[model samples]
Target: MTHPENPSTFDTVLVANRGEIAVRVIRSARAHGYRTVAVYSDADAGAPHVALADDAVRLGPAPAADSYLDVDAVIAAARTGGAQAIHPGYGFLAENARFARAVADAGLVFIGPTPDAIDLMGDKAAAKRRMADAGVPLLPGYQGTDQSDETLLAEADRIGLPLMVKAAAGGGGKGMRLVTDATDLRDALAAARREATSAFGDDTLILERALLHPRHVEIQVLADTHGNVVALGERDCSVQRRHQKVVEEAPSPAIDAVTRAAMQQAAVTAAADIGYVGAGTVEFLLDVERRDGDHQAFAFLEMNTRLQVEHPVTELVTGIDLVEWQLRVARGEALAFGQDDITLDGHAIEVRLYAEDPSNGYLPQTGTVEAWQPPTGAGIRVDAGIAAGQQVTAHYDPMLAKVIAHGRDRDEARRRLADALDRLVCLGVTTNRTFLARVLRHPVFAEGGATTSFLTDHDVTGVDLDPRDVAAVAGWRQLAATADAERRSPGLAGWTNATWLVDSRPLRVGADDRVVSLQATVDGIVVTVDDQRVLVTGTPDALRVEGRPVHLTVHRPGGDRLLVHLPHVDLDVSDPTGLPPGADDAAGAGVLVAPMHGAVTAVAATVGQQVEAGSQVVVMEAMKMEHVIRADVAGTLVEVVDVGDQVGVGAVVARIDPADTDG
Candidate 1:
């Protein structure tokens, strides 16, 4: 039932998400002469999306459960703001079938796939059934309704080893685990079920045969009411960490013309089978086993019945605005261009710039954005949500912005991405900037063999701290020490610090607990490493280390540390450990510590329960991800945090009483 409407009839539309995607949607809506309404949580009251909207409405509080995920609140905001349609900007309630139905019931057009399509694709098990019925390829495994662990383990043993346990209703790689051994099947099932329950509210599990070197390839599909479904080429989302996509690029390097065409056709079939409208993506795991002479196989992963985060890259390459198409399709208008008219012109790559520390197990970083600047140049675009001074709390996704670059070829696109990274700057919070740079610089990445397990195979575990980087760090630290000593004494280098003979202080670099001791002298500076002295000299601003002038990028006050930006790297020198312990661990041993600042969603551990190493102890929800704290060593659980409790970093959540280990 296509509603006949004049082209460009939507005067107002409400963005139904927060952060960068909301801002991105608003900007697109405005570009098409549609007035935009922004809905915000309490934490995002002052976010950039709120400032960019034609009208803004407060939904609820920081927790997504109270705000963005609240269907009634979002619909109310749309109605109060006089929006004719609501555009869910991915994530949150974007793919919620009930929310879509509610929006339609409220007489406001939902600018996405129909509720039927959402329901068909939102559930992984159901979607697989549809795809399988549609003759799409599927990985060999069980996707049944059985919930018993014993049954699942038996099925896994029958299906063979190396399989993935996935949530039947999950997206974004949450509630996913790889089981390679039968002995660990029960634990994997429990953990995956727990994560799936927390993430998607559906604990039902599905098992898929694992591909050793799988590349995550997906095809973008667009559909209209006129039965026009077009597959807009393919994208490679192989670079991932913790099962979450971090980098994506258009036109996969692994697929040939035949494979690409097959993939596109599969996506079109998947979309058409569900009578889908609007934009959607069909994800597949491409198996490349050249070593075993196994031909490449693409299996149906899932269907995201909404616009993807990497849609910008597709838009850039095709010169087609998917958002505009979504609006047009929702308005009952036929697509402006046909498949024959569309051209996949240049290559485009998108990198998600998140407020996270990769070295610290990718923990979300929270702080006020003191400075936020996105790179701007030809073929460079940034969809950013926060501005300088905006607080990036731990209440939402760590993704602060998305940086995309376009070029005539992959090399040119890579170059443009690097150039943009150089101009991009953010202060007052640790981000994945340095790690993104490393990924781009990776040799295999340049050669186009980056798979989903790239990080697992590569040595990115010691990110931001390399041996070569350490030497340069020492050089920069000594230079800063020399300059500080000169400034402390007015007579030397014509400066004053009100102290003489700069004392030796210990400075610890990032992650590594090893300390480098340095002392400031009138003539020069000296760094003692393992009781060996290395002479250094420098000015306060510029230093001549061994007659080579070294420049320090930033001088952090209250210490002898300096931020040094060199030709090859950047380093920060500061005390690794701060503040002395208030009490001995023996005084409070067996006290459960909060993994990080977050709300306790579930406390699985209890008094007198014997737990093994890596056993699930407590579940803390932070930045929308449920982190399960495990016992570091085998012990008897003595205490635990209550469910629904909010705790800060280092706040005790649970503790295990030590038990004798000698058998």
Candidate 2:
């Protein structure tokens, strides 16, 4: 399907990215008869994408600045790999105009839109102006060149309250803040600038009027050098957490036939207006009145000049390979079909599987994945970067995979996706799999009524840690230790031969630590916690808990950690009976622990400074987001880590001495 009009295009492609997207692009490129090259950092030497590529080149160290974001390093890597085309997957430098230009200067074809299109749309302010000029409906706000703090504040007044202060240069909510009150505008502006500068290296700010309870939807468009453009349906990305999309689907339940057509035409027009080429997405903010209002119901949000993370949903629904289309377009291929030929066949849903705990404000997690088993069934596809023994580091985003499902209808797709998520067994690291299932099956979401405020508006936290799971883990420890002892010395498994000996085991699961009493017997294993005795019988893997057979998978990831998978829950519990409790424990309340591995970006506490309980002591940056570490109890600061200090998860960043009670 490719023509040779573009001299820069070639048979070899260098994927200038990492993680799942890198794996995705490499697979597509190879499948389409192109040689694939992968670039990796020191931390990702054994990554999935690198191993899958026919050739791979090292970029730099773990930090993105020294690795993926380095324009010269990427271009040099392409040159060394002898790749004629470079594919910058989503994130990192995908939307970086300078990176695109650098690829062209290296005589390499960038498998994306031109540098001009990237620059025009990458900057939110400029893209909004351009879209407005194209007669695209847009929300009223400030998108001017003036980025001064005073001027922005003045403009906020004109735009009214509940306006968004966003980093004009990037997406993914890195530098976005919602200001509902006038008093919080200044702080929001400062925070947004700081975050924007850290994430995108661009502190340019733009203000947009915030819509209440809106849905996030975007249109997928492809353009070729042959003056052909086509719209490939739409994707709904309304379910979000912290402004980042957590779930996406195609053939949005909210959009009707009339609205879909209008949105599709508008997106096609937007792409034509910018003279964009290759694959791109035009995002919009859809108000609640989807079908009633014509153009007034929706407004242009921003245009992603690169392949989106949620593109698989659109692909599944449209039965198209967007990556292939991008390659063909870059190689001067004409459109094989037009908009009239495009059609949505079915409903598709995709959930972002992240290495994070949903109960703890979705704090990003990092560790070695001891075992990973992605779900497999009809209409299910998983685009993942993780594997058994793969290390999930703190240097990058915590998203480990994308689990997608498709069916003939929305309900079938929803249930299928939920079931697939439940069956997914990824141990060693905590994830939001259960939360995702809950969101899918929730009444609002099930009825296709979820909006951007779904996460905050719903009670998605009803699932509790089953007592039997704790007991089962305790029984597993006893059985495992007994088996190991018997392996080393026959008939030396337990101290007592007449009766099973009971032992108390300290187990910790997501901030709750309990001492479980259990005994292993020839008949079964008995565990008691909270005065409840639970019986577990059967082999280690196949177990019947409390006389009821339960499906389970367990992995010992060294030390005292045990990853227990039970149905829809995967609990990474640490057996702390032999090891001493760390300083972050409740007994050491004055110690402020780093929740995750990150660099200390700010320090508010100092030695000999008086502080109160719940006061911010330090702020750490990881995965391009800032997390504040606060003191646990009232005390005077005695020890505090300075800025630029790299700390690991559970590392104490600060210590406070209890205030003198004599006073």
Candidate 3:
């Protein structure tokens, strides 16, 4: 690890990030024979990365601003741990120029681009000017110095309607909004500014024409300190939700060899022209509607000065360890190979599994993971920092893990990824596993025809609970009750007894209620759902329903609730077996509740004030995104919560009484 050009040999590397990316860098650093230090928030003290590192440092509490985003705390940790370099793994302070400069000032290597490079590209406003000057094709929009509201409004009108207002200081879909109507421009600007200030500490924004049904394509570029830069190829990240990427694949199904070469060259030129070093991605938006045969026109989106979340696809196809190279470049090492030496083999696809519910507007979910079973196949890989009993909180990003698959071709890779998603089990919290599997297996995505509008353009509904799932839980509960009562003799396959009380159990699974009648018999426990009876014979883990074997991982988390992990979706069922038959049928949305655990950022309505349907009642911030709680019915506010109040999930934030009758 010694280099004559750079005499400072770094034996210890500190990862200044969290979640899967932190685990990712730590693994690579350890593989290269370097002692690793993991910096974590109080929330991540028991995280996988902390356990994997040679030593660990606590940054602060769970909130990122006081912990991962704190520049001084990170530098102090690097110094205390005797780390020679710090790797900001893709988020938090990854693209922060101040953090990069501080690392250099502290005599430690920042394993990314130089501070100047970060400054040039981290701010989207400045990056657009530079790229445009460099002759990169771009959308016509405003990226000016005057950030006044009047100026922005005039510029926006000039740029025309249906444009995007984005935060200049950050990426990853934060502080971004699309305005289709002229009347929504003010609200969009205000929301974008608020989110940007909270996310990136900069309210400066840039506007761009929102191309209809465009495909997001990005090129991976790696440069060494010795002026050796190479383009590793392109990845299509067209499948998205809320401007964030969901599914990504290498060697895009949309573009051909000729367009690939052109895009690759363009990325190389941009990276080389800016004197970029280390791992970075140059993003582009392909106008699918304006396609001309094999030559689809793509415009420069932005250049992320740090590694991208979807870099795994590039790595799988190119057989390159990106984190290892980031360390090497930071240590002033020259590239061992050049552009001609690089090769792309096969195909790869990756999907991010987040702790979020798909049916309910994709609201973020937070709960302890009772079971986590990642699928393992020939070419499947799981990058995660989660474990059983890990409490996923709402203070950070909702993404829990990433599942990637590699195969000989696109279809093979697609099918492999879909299968892996189906087999992956993450219990306790609601996740997008089922939604992800649906995306991979969707006809458009499988055929490589997905655009940025893929998720919204098509109706990809949330996974429904299977009737067998309801039956399994019911049977298991009955078995447990009978065994505890000691009513019968011990029998086959962990069954201790049989139940005498042959009563019907009411189960509620994700807003749907069903009555399940059970009968304990000599053969096995029988479960009846909606007049249909099925013989369920098995333990809590595996069950044979109606003579067909089904594998399920069940977790009974106290009092009447069971979290069942199936092939696609994890169902959290409310099982009330003993009490009574007539359960209260609660309905109506008279009171507005916090959809998730979060801080009330804004109080949009006042008590006694009238609000129409879809009117904003309260604004809540959680997991780095703002969720506006709106009125579901036309009513007058009877109660309201103040700003800066911390509320838990389902806590009443506001209440609205029905509007007065016309008579």
What TM-score would each prediction reach against the true structure? 0.87, 0.94, 0.94
TM-score of 1: 0.87
In model 2, pairs of residues that clash are none
Q: What clash pairs does model 3 have? A: none
RMSD of each: 4.1, 2.8, 3.1
Ranking by lDDT: 2, 3, 1
Give the per-residue lDDT of model 1 (tens digit) for 564-604.
44433445566544535853233234555765678888777
Which residue pairs in candidate 1 collide? 487-496, 488-496, 488-497, 489-495, 490-495, 538-543, 592-653, 592-654, 592-655
Off by over 4 Å in 2: 1-9, 290-296, 479-504, 519-523, 580-590, 604-615, 631-638, 656-663
lDDT: which is higher, 1 or 3?
Answer: 3
lDDT of 2 at 106: 71
Q: Which candidate leads the pack in lDDT?
A: 2
301-354: candidate 3 lDDT, tens digit per residue = 999999899999999999999988888787877888887888889999999999
| Model 1 CA lDDT for position 466 | 47
